[model samples]
Target: MLTPSVEALIQHLADGKFHSGKKLADTLQTSRTTVWKSVQSLQALGLEIQAVKGRGYRLTHPWERLNAEQITASIQVPEACPPPVVEVHDCLNSTNAHLLRTASLRPAASICLAEMQTAGRGRLGRNWVSPFGANIYLSLLWRFRRGESLGGLSLAVGVETVRVLRTLGLADLRLKWPNDILWQERKLGGILIEAITESQGQCVVVVGLGLNLRLPPGAADAIDQPWVDIRTILGGGSSRSDLAVPSRNRMAGDLSSRLLALLNAYGSEGLTPWLEDWRRWNCVLGRRVTVDEIGQRYEATAVNVTEEGSLVLRRDDGRRRLLAAGDVRLRVRHDA
Candidate 1:
């Protein structure tokens, strides 16, 4: 229930104009004192409202906030996700590190989102370039008990991420071997799932996801391979800085919901339901590939992924090898 003066201030901020106190008061048919009080309240709510003596208040920068209230309001739930105890941070070293530090105190379903990640990371200790203003940089914390092998957790998350992406109309999104998501031949996004298991019998997995929303300027130089962004998937009339996607908010809500459903489904139904979906979107199958684990390299023809989540392949000598875990690199085929 904003007063007329408060509404006027909001409009002025959105319009990016410098309105004096007298001008704001006249626009709202209110006194200058009321206008000043209203501006004070917005500043209290994490807004960088810069005040000037001659001019009036102005926002320091454009808004890129992902508030829970906004996200929850944007979604219509089929079955409500376990309402994630959401934590919003202006900056962090890495959401994964934050989650791991507070793991014991954290509730079962909690999500940590950072507007800027100072030290975000990726699989095999790769540096994830998480710029301040562009990307859905977050980590989700979920727990499992003793004796649950941590192997297929990344695959499970990959399935869930694809489900979310499919809802956004990217139906042809494919999974590249381990956890990279690809559209056509370019990389879309990647997932990293790291776990901590105690000797007694408890496990906690921090699932970290880095999705390219809008590529920041000069960001492509850092990436060594083919990459894609949301702007690339959609057309190119708009500027990279413009946050005009109507469904962006909805996608966030959908991601949270589907992730919870997948977590619950995995606990109850196991990974049986997701096997076929993975096969349909699998990028490594039928490709010439090399599996590099530790310092050893094994070259094989990508044949299939087993029901137990191991990769099954036939070598050049017409022999089969089952790879339990490794970095799979796809080689170019002359036939293509």
Candidate 2:
């Protein structure tokens, strides 16, 4: 957790430029010693701070902290729908957990974004790697009417994400089963959904997303699986490679708008409308794959996903299986 003073210091240094301790202290209305202490705390949070005797201090890499005003302005809400209430945090254990814990108090159509997550989570209890200013960590809270089924909600979210990325000029993006976005067999983002039913029969769901923007070398070392970030994908051709404030604000706003639109459509039409779009982005369809479910593993050829978003797998013995949940891994075929 970052104290107010530490967060202030980080904001002052967010431009990735050198700032004298005295100047920062003056701007923050604090002493130089306090600024130094805050800098030390930020370093503990995995930030690389470069301090020089005469040149002052600057972050090793560029970073633009999320701005609530910019993000809200970026989203284009329909006239009939109320705009989502957006909250930006300096740090949090997890955006989804926070929203879920406060589901009762928060209104429907709320979104939370954190610059850094101390305990980010993925599906099936996996640890999501989230480094400060290097990824997008966000959660959206939505309420569904009684008896409404959220069967293909995650897949729908993936489709919307792909749509937004494609609009931003990313090609060849694909969707993995359940809730993962991939680029050339490398993970680019993931989704996690948590839902609770209220006494009135309304279900509140928190849709969490973590998308890699630019992973620092040190942060990349912690990830066990192959991964890709937007910076690498853009190949220095786009301004997003710099991770500037304006670029981040634009990307965040674009994503939020697309996701909100998708949720609105899903509420009205369910997943049926998104089934064809999901197939367009499906990467594993017709590919040999391995699925691990409840401590058991099975190898099969990936077929198509059902309209309800369940994966269909065809085994060697001509058995077709429907898997509602599991961890899927693309298999390398020796024969190929």
Candidate 3:
């Protein structure tokens, strides 16, 4: 359960800086033995702690909370839309779920950020592993007029997210159709868009995003898919580029600024503006993939993706595209 003392201990070690045992004990108002026990509990949770005989203990990497002031300062908003206030929580069942319940009362671009999530979710009800202070878990509320075509909104969100990631010096990135952000064909992050249509031509959409920044060894054991994080991409020295992942606050701020700009444009322009980007980053196009839909499964070569968000497949029998809004799983094996 990570009692308050343990959480307090974490705040002290968050910046990748070592705190001596004596200092930690004094700060937490506990004895050295109790502080050591608390550190063990955190290690038990799969967080890597580097303890030296002389230097003390620190996290494997720096972790930062979602800072509201830093986020708003970095966001460049249009004159019409003020920077949405961020609701930062230490933990929540799901940022998306919480915003869905309250989006009706909030204006567009309202953001929800969390340090950790208990029941974080991805598309099609898969659990999104959310270890504390290790990744990005954000939900933003956007509304559209009832008649607006929501056809490619989810994919467009992916495009916007990838745009932000690219600006952050991420390379070899790809966008899987629907809502996945991929780096070298491995899942890096995802976008989930939930919509509620009212009786009076109003629609409320909650867009949730989860990106791995610094996942610990055992924290993501439940994830069935091959996942990659920002540190894994750049920090691993696999890439020759000098890119580095920014602090959590800056990452959140960059993502928020770009995504909000997207909501403002996507509502009116539809997917026309993002089609060019889709062609550049889509990993599904010209790739062999298996599609599972409603108990039927088939393999096909993806030929195209329409602006309406249809997946065009070239099968041995004939060419077809899926346009229905339902459970669609594209099992794409990485060969390219």
Candidate 4:
């Protein structure tokens, strides 16, 4: 949680320049001791604050805070969809939870972004690691007057997200079945979709996304699976060394705009148009894998994904099964 004083201090130091404690205190109308304590708190939030006796304090690396204005400006609303309402927060428990709670009051294309999440979540109730100002934690609300099945919404979202990232020059990205983005078999990001239908046949959907821009060391320690961030990918190799890494604000704007465009396209055409794209990016297609469903594990050959985004598996006995939901894992040769 960021206090008002800390928020004020961050604004003053956001330029990546040194500001004396006395100067900050004077500007914020607080005591120097308070300024000192606030700086400590900022450092605790994974921000590298360099404190020198002569230079005072400044963020070690450039930190770009999320700007609602910049995000709004970057969005291009189509004639069929309403202009999005963008909101940025210093901290939130969960952006999806917030939108779900207030879905009835908000219109379509409503978006919420957070710098830090206290209770960030992923599919199947997994804890999403979110450090302050280090990654993208966003949720957007879309409404439909006539209810739609939304059977393949998550896969469509993944396809759009991959397209946006690839446009930004990140390579070797792939999509995992259901709701995951991967780079070289390691998780890079994920999508979570929540929906509720009203009695009148209107449905409201909340699409939540978490992408790792620069995961702090401590935050990465909590993740059980192998994962990678955009920074490491862009910073590696001769080919990508010249690529310019985008600021968080810019990335947010790009992602939001692309996602809105995707929503509009999906509304018109459904998941059929995106099925080929999803198949092209499917990382585990044709691999021997196991799907854990309700305490039973089904090991089979992944044949292909259905148009509705269900996994089509070929069992040992020449039987084919279409699974809607399960935890999927690649089966090694030793396991067979």
Residue lDDT tens for model 1, 183-260 = 777877888777787555678878888887766545556877788776567644355424443244456667767666
- Report the backbone clash tally of model 2: 0
The collision pairs in model 1 are none
lDDT of 2 by residue, 1-336 (tens): 678999888888888899999999999999999999999988877788999998889997677778999899889986556668999987899999999999999888799999899899998788998887768998999888877768789999998888888877788999988898999889999999899998888999899999988787788898988898887887654655565222667778888887788777777788888889899888778888877666777788888888777888899899998878545444424343
User: Which pairs of residues collide in candidate 4?
Assistant: none
Models 1 onward score TM values of: 0.75, 0.90, 0.91, 0.91
User: Residue by residue across 1-336, what tens digits does model 4's lDDT show?
Assistant: 688999998888888789988888889999989999999999888777889997788986567889999889887777677889999998999999999998878888999999999899998889999889889999999876575557788899999899889988888898888889999878899999988896667788889999998787878998998898887788874445323457778778878887888787776577887889999998767778876776777788888887777888898899998877545444423243
* Model 1 segments more than 4 A misplaced: 1-63, 72-83, 198-200, 236-248, 326-336
Instruction: Put down candidate 3 lDDT per residue, 72-121, tens digits, no spaces.
Output: 78887765664587888878999999998876678888899987899999
- Rank candidates, TM-score, best first: 4, 3, 2, 1
Model 3: how far residue 64 lies from native, Å: 1.5
Give the least accurate 10-residue stretch of model 3, judged by summed lDDT: 237-246
Instruction: Please give the TM-score that candidate 4 achieves against the real structure.
Output: 0.91
